[model samples]
Target chain A: MTGVLLPLLSFFFAASIVSLGWADMLIIVIYFLLVLGIGYYLMHFTKTGDDFFLAGRKMTMWIAGLAFISANLGSLELMGWAASAYQYGILATHWYWIGAIPAMLFLGIIMMPFYYISKTHSVPGYLKLRYGESSRMLAAISFALMTVLMSGVNMFAMALVMKVVIGWDINVSIWVSSITVMVYVVLGGLLSAIFNEVLQFMLIWFGALLVPIIGLVEVGGWSGMVAKIHQNFPAGDYTHLWSTLGHFKDNPMGIQWIGIVFGLGFVVSFGYWTTDFLVVQRVLSAKDLRSAKMAPIIGSAFKMMVPFIVILPGLLGLAVMPGLVGQNQAAMTGAQSYNEILPLMMARYLGPGLLGLGVTALIAGFMSGMAGNVTAFSTVWTYDIYKPLHLAATKREVADAHYVKVGRWATFIGVVISIGTAYLVQSAASIMDYVQALFSFFIAPLFGTVILGMLWKRATASGGFWGLLAGTASSIGMWIWVRIDPSALRIIAGSPDAKAMAEDMYRGLWSWVICVVVTIIVSYSTQPKAEAELVGLVRGCTDLPSEGHLPLVKRPIFWAGLILVAFIILQIIFW
Target chain B: MADEKLKSDSRATDSPERISIWFFIGAVLLVYGIIILIASIPGVSSPEGAQHVMLADLHAGIWWGALLIVLGAVYVAIFRPGRKKD
Candidate 1:
């Protein structure tokens, strides 16, 4: 949710930016009907808890792969990153390339086998297997709370975007979108969510691709774009990716190389891609081990192409619409906010039919994001929190049918809670800033604990729990410290010129470091679990399945290597 | 017991009656492509119909709409559910 709204919190629009025609309204209405139709069609197949939670563990590689990438391709990401590109130039592409591709490939090649073989339903379930009940409980409660709150954040953000973009009423946007998402999700669960995500993925590409295509044509081409930007800001460097990163003040983003490399590329990116259950749940639905292993590789291939639609449009805005102001100045001077670039570009280029398609695509992005969060929230709430608590209190195992019923109820309840959160956010806008900050506290430390438990046989359960606790506490402490004293940003980010984004990266790095250090120290002091009990859960004790007998073209490692080569080539081309 | 049940549930997903997700994608795209293609015809006849966007002469709606139609048709043909052999 923070990922969707973090860059957009400053936006405050006084009037509608664009008006939609009948063609646009028709396209959006068609999208709503199709999603609900999918849910109603799939309802018959959603008979058991497994089907509702994990898509019956039966998705093909292409389906799961597309859904995995699409789940993260929310409207906030599209608009927010486009704004970032306008604000920071081509440096924003780093968030897509170095920040995402490596982490996704790492998840596919290094981390997937354990997750696939263990048959864990969620990330917290994996923790339960490796770190005991207490660790699982801690991870599950925090994750469940965070996921629902984030859903609410996405909901409110979508409503706000609608009210600003086409003058839709905020209450109408909130209720209509919320009810549509709730009906589909409650009817079909994860399968419905995954299916809609795939559809949303296609819609986003088709609807938004024209903006860059038209923008590039107007500016001439790539060289023409570079020249126009150069003409616009002669003293600043916007076209080059790596040349201006020698110092904090040298770059438009005020970020240094170390923060980009370690803080974002290594810590924050890995933490989100490798461990976030909203995305990982999609991969877990793959039919077999090989499919699971290949899914993220497929996702990364598509992920590399996303910057063409997202980042290029922002850079194009910088070239074509050079006088856009920051949100603060926009409110005072009545100039366009940088956040309005995507819709502005859409309105500038798209005609009647195409304009409708673009609007539908934005709506699809928002709903897909909402469905992803709600589905993941319901699964975690049911499996990790509710089922365990019910078992402990009643001392009996529930029937599969009963659990499936409970899951449906959880789905409905989760959506209601999310709608409530959206209204709360509407009443108090500053809640978004606090919620976004609170989200960063868990991810880095959770990654540290999970990765340690998976790889190191010596990591004790006590170490995992205590390390996670300490890391989270310290992250919150650091956020408060920086909040109370603005000068503390320099200490945290390692430079006086460091900006807000740099502070985030550096804080993630420090929290992760604290987690790893505390885990090792505590593990050495505690008694280790028996080696016999570690089979199938840790690296050395488990025998990995062989794929060497297959042809070279069929191996996951081959595709991963190909993706790595593509990633490096992109870096060189942009450099 | 729960694990065993989950393993068994995987078989249910392969039921012959289950519809392919691709077919829905293809169907939606085909409908959208047809509508846009028809809509672009008026634009081609009168410049006023194009809404005065950049590159109005290129008739992007015609090309883009035709491309979606062809792609959507192919996906529908290949992945249509209820076919016995799939």
Candidate 2:
């Protein structure tokens, strides 16, 4: 421990970092108190497992909508994407725009009706409704493992950021944050997490918006920033969105338009935004079908604006603050890492009170992220895993209170495991990367299984089970194959010069295709369920709820169309 | 029918009596805004750390803080606990 502490202390000390003032400290303390207060307040209302896991299905559109996006807007995403913008240029906006908006809108306009109508407690629960037990258990086990590991990743990243930015001890940051999250989530469950996520959304926008606002002011404006970037790197075309993507080697990111469109836009984005339970759970808390559908649409609208605070800072760094380098280079030469661009910009512009708010926003982001994962983990554990085993043992239904009790315990145990995972990540950074990638491996295949089960009535239980298994296996196999032989990248990504990001996109596309094809083949060979059993589970058999009485302006499809128009306009403007 | 039953059952058990989430958001923002406004007062010496940033004279804290206070005020007024819904 002493040996680890010595090197870590020296590394952080060598970096020039800022300290917080009294006002900053006061603001942060207030936020911590407020979150815990929310938990205590909500504890009174939380009696059943429904209240603990699904917020009693009573969240308004705006509340659920803000939280739906906020759950994804973590410090890891904020810092990582900002760094990507700095390194890869405005092309990074593709992740927010093309990659996310389409899928979110699809979730609202197309997919949400099914999820809302089924009234299943979870995505895995829906799988059980449609396919059978095996598929649900597989998904639940994978989701539970991934969610807790991700909570740990968020915890470790928060500690690392605090240590780098304000010189806080790693252990102190990790434990304080983990304990805070555990207290609130164990107290009130998903509602507590949702409340904190909404607060986090507001704080992130208000706290970080100044960077892009002041940055654009300092660099003249968008045109000026673009010109300055062009001047800085005469050979690099950093500003154009789609114009530079004629070939893999044409852009700094080494990705082509095809990968952007099909791989990321269709496969990876849909898999995450549509199927991933963490974000989906937020929308599931909506009071009605319209609100549920509107939630993801509202989320997409907010998501489209995230690039201004995130990607704009990285672009601004390129225009103004040069000399930021890659991580290994930064460590070797005492230069700033691109990942530190967000904090460095905050330091450059924000003063005492605002600095504290900025830092608090980051802390809120990390905590909300941890809370989201932990709460989701607890829900899946109790509903999908623990309850099943208990029922098998007792052969009887337990009281709702018993499951609620189990959820609280699961929340505690999940946080403890996450802490252990965080410490493990601290020891081996590579473990964090693999865990994140491993989580991604499940997403594409899961999306395929869920979508097929929802859309096609012929999708058999065996087909859903085997298809998901094969898809996940193939994704892992491809990852290992590429890791073993560097030359396999040409076959996987279709370009010799394609970067790691492109590899991820293509991998998702292939795995999803494999899952779909296998499901069709196996589904044909296996016995299909009777039409009577398919109601409310598969699309054609289910009579979807009608919102035709709503005005055009109030309809989710209308707003989805408008959002799509705005999304296209953004692409053209950025291009 | 089942979905409606679930919705009404859950609604009957929760919703109306609980404290509003918006109130908490408003309260936090209001306090933070006031703190920031106080810190940004003219002739208050700038912190040792922020002395060198460009546009220091622009006083972004004042504008942002005022915006927050106004937004916070509206949220608190509209959604404060025990206020009757229209």
Candidate 3:
């Protein structure tokens, strides 16, 4: 204990000023122990593969909804978005609203019935049911790899936060967080992970709420913050959401509303919110069809408010910590830069005890993100990769206990590999760039295939496979083309001012277009499956039950409408 | 008979009908709130190793704690098994 304390003390001394007191440390320690305890306790409930992976298909709407957002409430959503807000101004909120809300609504209203009725364990499982083994294999392999890498990104981001705020060794932070996540997830599976996510969701709100509230007070109010931003950065349009977004050169984001609406909102957003198994898995865990549908709607409601916790801090950082941006300080040096805005705000505003909670909230965000990725990876590996191989070789169904064991082993192995990936991320130039590139490669094409297969009955299995392959290949090809000749990127993105993010959106849009066109042309040439065979898989072939029996307020459509109205109101207000 | 027993056991253990997560959350909030409130007293050692403190130091904990406890209670109340409609 003394040995441990000595190094920690020495590291603390070497690091910046100690922001946490003994009481704050006690609170953080207590929170960790409670999480571990919950994970261990939930393990006893997980007896089979279904229970382990899908929580016995018994999650309520609230649980599914909170977990859905919490799984995504990673350091990237909090810290990365805050950092983006600092850079791009309030225009970054479009990623939350236009980029997320409509897609979530589409998922709930249009996609849920297919996902729920099919009873597929994973997203690739859905592809297998809709398309064929070849498509399934392609998707499964890519998704499995992507999930693990994303987990590593989360791990890296978390370590970066700890290094910045607490002055801990990045490796130590990675191992500690990885081991904790592994223990809980390996023990209790998805249920424990979701449970902790819900807890983390609450803590995040509690921890981050103070920043915006205190900031608004200090800056006088919304009007005052706006005035400060305008006065300080005279050239930047930090307040307007859509009015200035006529073209790439017109706005701070350097992308037009077309990119925001079509690329991010339509292609990338739909691709991720609709098809990405990381979030969809939570909804799939819902006990009933209605609950599953309600989950994303609930999540969307919470998601609409997320810019408050995430982007507001960045805005405040702009007003308070002037000159924090454009510094490009190395993360390891613990220098206060734009990326450290969230923690810097907490350090300045939050006193000792609350500061502990704030730090814990950031840690919770990172851990939940890592845990969500690891759990998804383990499930995808076991169900999609390992089980398929095992079945092909043995030609037999394994016992539930056996699959459960494989899931646990996969979780352990996934975390270990993620630690390595985390180190790679640590060495990377910028984690945001790396993650966005991966998303364009995987998510954009996956969405194109999924949406086409779901909506178009004539989409052949061969078409699905080839189209996905082409889309992914094209995205990579485009990226390389741009990299080789910097001028080519200007042509591809349609703007000289297009940054990496704008380039990503354009790439997603072009890849999606390529995917859809290829799928249509190839599908016409290939043999199509019978309409009867495609029932429940295709949109028009299936008949969904009327939801009219429910009360107006209780209905998913009603909530979706209310959310849409709220969205319109926000757009108008910010316009 | 054995198969029937196994099915019944599985059904019973599969998923809890009532929500208990809020209860746990409430308990955590109550505990944290009490601890912070206790520590905020004049005699308790400040985490920053200071002898004196201000109302702002304890303000966040007390208020946030109270809010959490209330929210947890509301969740527990609303989600308790008897209130759930099929």
Candidate 4:
């Protein structure tokens, strides 16, 4: 009874807020239909575990490229990204430009060389061949855990953002949206994921692109925003860039550039670009070896500009409501909560007609990310863990053969778990932060072990096995320290208007250090494994594409050029 | 297929072809370096940085779209798809 009536009731409420009932309902219904219809259509393309997991390894670099971009786009980006940029100050801005851009190129030029040569369906399965079974299983389990937890975070975020905008029950938003996203995602697996992502990317890019342009025109002009920013902030507040980083009572901006650029950025950049199943699967699904390698770079180049779509609006929103945003401690924490900034801004500002599109843009972003997450989870589980442990069919795991049906079921289960988790995740932190904090527990450890396994052949099975355990435990401990520490948690929980620099440092710096230190120490203490077995997995003869890998000579040339070019560009910006 | 192979960035004629890979990588690196340099500057700000952050904000469409076209060109060149024996 509630299921049918609630969304309808919510639809009317949504319609009434903007005062255009039928048109908005029609747009939402049509968009939902289009997603389901296309998802079902893409499902027809799946034939085997590889087909389900890797889209039969026949995706064009362009489609795969678009899908790769879509994997990063989620409903949360509009609000979450803008909110973070609005609150976190400038250095946090490095993630998209410096981090994502380089990370993509690295994956294309380096990781692709190995993936193409090895022809492994799963990223972790390659680890098994390169390191041992222990590394493979450990990576696989960690990936599943990360995906499930991340999905919950995504669901909670999607529901919360919509609830704030439409005044709907969070429960109604979760199941309705999750079930809809799951239907198409499960029906086709990566095929559906790629298909939906292509559409989602197109819409999200358009939707986000529309916001600042519309918001700017509607409010006043570009200079008008600057005037407003000054009006809202104290005289000196709107004038300083790096001042936000230094302005913390407890320093909510986080530990300086080292933590922001390298520690936090490097760890996350590598984890998502290299090891994450979602983005890797898109690259893996590329039509040929060259396309797979090139896909990430293509996607990344596009991502450099996402800050405009995502982060700028929050900053601009402050310009709209100068007196309301508050300054000093509240303002800095507002910057830290980052994800809440976008939706609240959108709800508070924007005209009715544009509001529909803003909401639509947010929906597209959510679907794109959710589609990426569930698809990756399905592929890693069905291909790596499930088939190896329970099923004994070699023919089923091949590039094109026997496991489509089961793979779809695995995707469905992943979606269900995601919905359950989403409902459980609280609205305390912005969706991205809550998800990131949880995901870092799983991902940070995996990042440490993978770097060791890839760079050092002597990294033993027992070493990787225990290294993963130690990394995860340490990350969780660091998170607890930040929370339970009388200083940080009190500030995070809003009990006191706190001022502690070390407390902010815990949020940004400590987790990555803990993971890297623990992983290296544990891996170093273990014995070496047989190098001969890892040969075909990381370096093989058969499928090696002549063109894809970054040539040895090319590296130094690029590094030097990068330094020179960066020098000139900065000279212009600064001088 | 022959034309595709001939024009392909990696399709160098033996050692000369392999050497150009270095050249291509160098060009790409130059783009990245430009970005880093922009950030490394002493007083350059961001979107919400003291200045209203509008230069990159307002013109992102022009730059990212134009950059996308340039990247798209690289992709289209790679995607031309050659015959196996060519």
TM-score of 4: 0.73
The true-versus-predicted C-alpha distance at residue A73 of model 4, in Å, is: 1.7
Q: Which window of 10 residues has the lowest lDDT sum in candidate 1 chain A?
A: A5-14
Model number with the top lDDT: 2
Cα error, candidate 3, residue B30 (Å): 1.8
Residue-level lDDT of model 2, residues A411-448, one tens digit each, is 99999999999999999999998999999999999999
**Once model 4 is optimally superposed onto the true structure by TM-score, how far is the C-alpha of residue A145 displaced, in angstroms?**
2.6
Cα lDDT tens digits, model 3, A115-185, are 88888998898899999888889988988887887788777777767876878678878887889989999
Kindly report the fnat of each predicted structure, to 2 decimals: 0.37, 0.38, 0.15, 0.00
Error (Å) of candidate 4 at residue A55 is 1.1
lDDT of 3 by residue, B5-31 (tens): 323332333355533565456566655
Q: Count the backbone clashes (under 3 Å) in each candidate.
A: 1, 0, 0, 16
Candidate 2 vs candidate 3: which has greater lDDT? 2
Better of 1 and 3 by TM-score: 1
| Residue A436 C-alpha lDDT in model 3 | 51
Sort candidate 4 into its docking category: incorrect
For candidate 3, the per-residue lDDT at B19 reads 38
lDDT of 4 by residue, B22-79 (tens): 2222233233223323332322343342132223334333343344345444544443
Residues A492-541, model 4: lDDT tens digits? 42334333433333333344455556656766787665666555444332
